[model samples]
Target: MTLEPDLRDDLLAAVPSLRAFAISLSGHVDRADDLVQDTLLRALSNLHRFERGTNLNAWLFTILRNLFHSQYRKRRREVEDPDGSYASRLTVQPEQGARLDFEDFRTALSTLPHDQREALLLIGASGFSYEEAAVICGCAVGTIKSRVNRARSRLSSILKVDATEAIGSDPVIRAALHTAR
Candidate 1:
């Protein structure tokens, strides 16, 4: 059976209040209109489940609230990447590439002179300042700086990497390259 004439009129009269409630809940006119339309559709479809003597307005409001909450829960897991920048960053580069890059870096580092390697390691890997490295190496701070610079230049040339280019995902390797640049 269809909705009674009086109930239909009641539903028609409830539209303004429903729209206002929807707007207040959603804070967007387009979304509020959609919520009200969905609520009316659900109410009409499920009229048999709605008791006749009870409140109809409350039932519609409950439906609208439940719809909003369901939408919210579903949206919580979604990322709004309209421009695809976030999606672009989600891809993992091949593990083999990183491994090969790391091996190349190690080989280049091993070819550096002993003093230059010590200076680069003390400054880049060990996080020591030039003065601190000089004290440890029993040399002048300028000498330590020169050795690090020479070592970085030699490694970059040996690895065939541009000074500005980043190599691998390893933090230590990245830090060394970044300082070199």
Candidate 2:
């Protein structure tokens, strides 16, 4: 059932904080906004199921969190363009150098063990605190830190990443390298 007018208005008012939380979770503003929109739509559709007098903020967050995890899982099975052959064909000449670095970074990222990769992405890319990531990953904070550390070490080893070098200029690689150091 659709949300009543009053409930919809309340949801609209919560957009800003919801967007901020989404950005924190997703890192990219674009992806976070998309998640917020999806969350709003889901909340509206499921309004009938929402219990009255409950915490709307918590409800919306739960919806967004569930959506992010679902999308994350879906992306895990999708093939990535490691060589940038597909992306390269669509980019202009000037941007191709950056694109190549991105491809190498992607290749190096894929080499890490899945747990480490998850920890790294959660803290480095997604901006989650170690404790928050541990909560999400169902592990202790120390475990999350250890996983991220191992992931960073493995990535540095695999890519021979130098903090002062050209590869470090790439933001994605730089974030990992920066945090590792």
Candidate 3:
């Protein structure tokens, strides 16, 4: 059975959760949106597979989650967080806000080496586990973890990130920096 007009509307309402789950799986916002759209389309096509009386939201989530897993298993390396900070560390250190220049931060990120960029994006920007990142990168998990750390060190140096001044001027960094402080 195809998703009827009413079912389609119900499907649409779950898009937000789908997108969020997609991002958690894929790391890139655009990619997440794309995944969500793909999931909806897939659901529409396979609506007959959905068991009536089962949870519609759960069914949709299963579709999206399964799709993500399929993509991940096929090629984990497809959308790895290239920057090492794992999305978790991208926050700016609060107290250092006064010293930040958005331009400088952007420029500095651009100046980072490719490997460094990859490391930061995967670990810092995406928030992937090292094991997951490594699987995605087709490398040892340790290598993935190391790349993240090394990239952080490189950024700290390039940005002249003072332990005292805060490692990042961004709130993410600020929260991390608070512990450091």
Candidate 4:
């Protein structure tokens, strides 16, 4: 399929940002890159259906996000890797407390409702304004804000971190927890 030069250029320009968004959504670099590749292929195949003047970035993002969710649902039934088998094979240093904290945070994050998690990530991690998130989520700005608030509150509860208390003494982690509260 031949894409117009301008359209091809625009799509190429969006790749890095799309991969970053995918990583934020998937939390796995390899999976994120694969998702990005799949998204691009789908976009190219559906190029004829795209409206010339529409927001291409938003369209691409919507496709990538939906793909992630669909894949996530399918992965739910898959078996996990054997516990220490995967971890023990990796060389670890004695001073890797930060990794443990990250694991805890990731666990807590995965517990949040999908809406809240997406809203929180779009605003907090992806640097999207509430309005932009609203547009992307196909909802009101107030709805996006509410989701982010609820997500943060739920995470704080799940992690058992008080607004004034710190997690792992890491300022970045502490600020994230505090801000959510």
C-alpha TM-scores of all predictions? 0.50, 0.45, 0.40, 0.45
Q: Summarize candidate 1's per-residue lDDT along 127-160 as a digit string, tens digits.
A: 9989999999999999998999898888878877
Model 1 pairs in collision? none
lDDT of each: 0.86, 0.83, 0.71, 0.84
| Global fold similarity of model 1 (TM-score) | 0.50
Deviating ranges (above 4 Å) for candidate 3: 1-3, 77-181
Model 4, 3-71: lDDT tens digits are 789999999999999999999999999999999999999998888888999999999999999999999
Candidate 4 lands at a TM-score of 0.45
- Which is the leading candidate under TM-score? 1
Residue 11 accuracy (lDDT) in model 1? 96
Ordered list by TM-score, greatest first: 1, 2, 4, 3
Q: How close is candidate 2 to the true structure, as a TM-score?
A: 0.45
lDDT of 2: 0.83
Question: Across residues 44-162, which tens digit of lDDT does each residue of candidate 3 receive?
Answer: 88878888778999998888899888887877665557776676666654654444644556667677777656766766667676788888888897777666666666666776766
Off by over 4 Å in 1: 1-89, 179-181
Clashing residue pairs in candidate 4 (N, C-alpha, C atoms within 3 angstroms): none
Count of backbone clashes for each model?
0, 0, 37, 0
